[model samples]
Target: MQRRFLVGLIGANIGKSLSPALHEDAFAAAGAQGYYHLMDLQVLQGRATLESLLVAVRTAGFAGVNVTHPVKEAVLPLLDEVSPEAREIGAVNTVVIGRDGRTAGHNTDRTGFRRAFEEVLGGKAAARQQVLLLGAGGAGRAVACALMDLGVQVLHVFDTDAARAQTFAADLQGRFGADRIRAAADLAGAAWQAAGIVNATPIGMLGYPGMAIAPELIDTRHWVADVVYTPLETQLIATARRKGCRVMTGGGMCVHQAAEAFRLFTGLEPDVARMHRLFNEACARRDAKLAAAG
Candidate 1:
């Protein structure tokens, strides 16, 4: 019998997510039967809680599900097991349902961000050896861990919730060393001294439309990256580019992460180049629709 897999994405405001197309197309290219569903909490309208959805999907024989945004951290404790990387990052973006009917949480965000940075930015952003990371949330945690893996000398983190930023820095300090990471109380000061700036918050995303840091804080000396892919060209990215700063969009991260998730789901290697092409096509369609609507 041919192998088949059922996977899904669980998050809010995910109606326009490109994950389904990305993973399903990869499965098609690999000649496997695959179905990717979206469990959008906003769309479900209180019909399901995160716990309830996980139970439903597991019971329905789902191979696994990808967790995102608000639920990435929330889904961690609910899993039967968590990979070391995910545990270290304190977030989980991908979950695998084992044959023994147990769920294991893993994070592809770290590898995804690492690949995107090396491939898209050509590692130029890390040249200064220091980076300013905005938002110490789930995505921020993943990126922070990736930066350490990439050999960043210093990471200055700032979050609207100062406590969250300090906590994230403290957690990473245990792994990357106390001198390598610090929580920043002044975003402008950190951005001024860093080689790159990363926005890991939802500020630049579709529902939340704004830059995490002021455009004035960005300069040619800085490379800016945002994890908000829906807009493709967020205000932060555009501002950075206009200022002659190298900018990496969230699209590359999204595609790379989905490619990793596809591998986890199917145990088969996916053509990442093909996935990137599909992602670009999807983004073009979304942009055109937004333009026509305006």
Candidate 2:
């Protein structure tokens, strides 16, 4: 008999996530019986806590779960062990349930973003340039670490929550150096000096629709990247493109990260090109649906 794998994604406002389609299709192609589910917090209506959800899924024979958005940091304490990289980033986006019943947390976000950036933008120029990064949450931390790894000379960090941004900057400064990372008090000022800008917040996602930075701040001199994949072309990306700035969408990160998560869940190398094709197909379907509704 062939083995079967079950996995899920846990997050709020994720009804439109493409993770399930991506993983399930990969599993089918790999000849495994796989079922990927979405455990939307908003849909759960508090019926189960994160702890309870983890327990329920594991008990029900799930192989693992992907953590997202608001729960990425919150899920850390629930894991039996965390990968060193995840510990360093203070976030967990992937959790695997071992056969021995121990759950280990690992973050694939950094690797995902790094791979996407390198693939889309030749790393040399971007690596040498200073970057203005928006947000300091779980995704932000991952992107910041990836940017530093890519050789960004300086990272100007900003978040709506000033204290959160300061704390995240302090943490990164301690790890990298005070010279490499600093919290930004002025968005326009930081963008004026940066060669690139990245948005790692949920601001431009489907449920949350808005640009993280002022459109006027973006110019032809800067490159822009966003991590919100639901609306592949966010207002930020659109604005930056109109200004002739190079842009990277959240779709690449979404596909790359899902590829890593697929490997962790099934221990099989997924065809990344196929995964990208599937992701693009899913996005097209989403866009078509929205267009029809409109």
lDDT of each: 0.91, 0.92
- The most accurate candidate by lDDT is 2
- Name the TM-score of candidate 2: 0.98
lDDT of 1: 0.91
Clashing pairs in 2: none
Clashes of each: 0, 0
Error in Å for residue 203 of model 1 = 1.0
lDDT of 1 by residue, 114-210 (tens): 9999998876558548899999989999999888877888999999999988998898899889999999998888988898999999997878888
Candidate 2 positional error at 126, Å: 2.1
Residue ranges of candidate 1 with Cα displaced over 4 Å = none
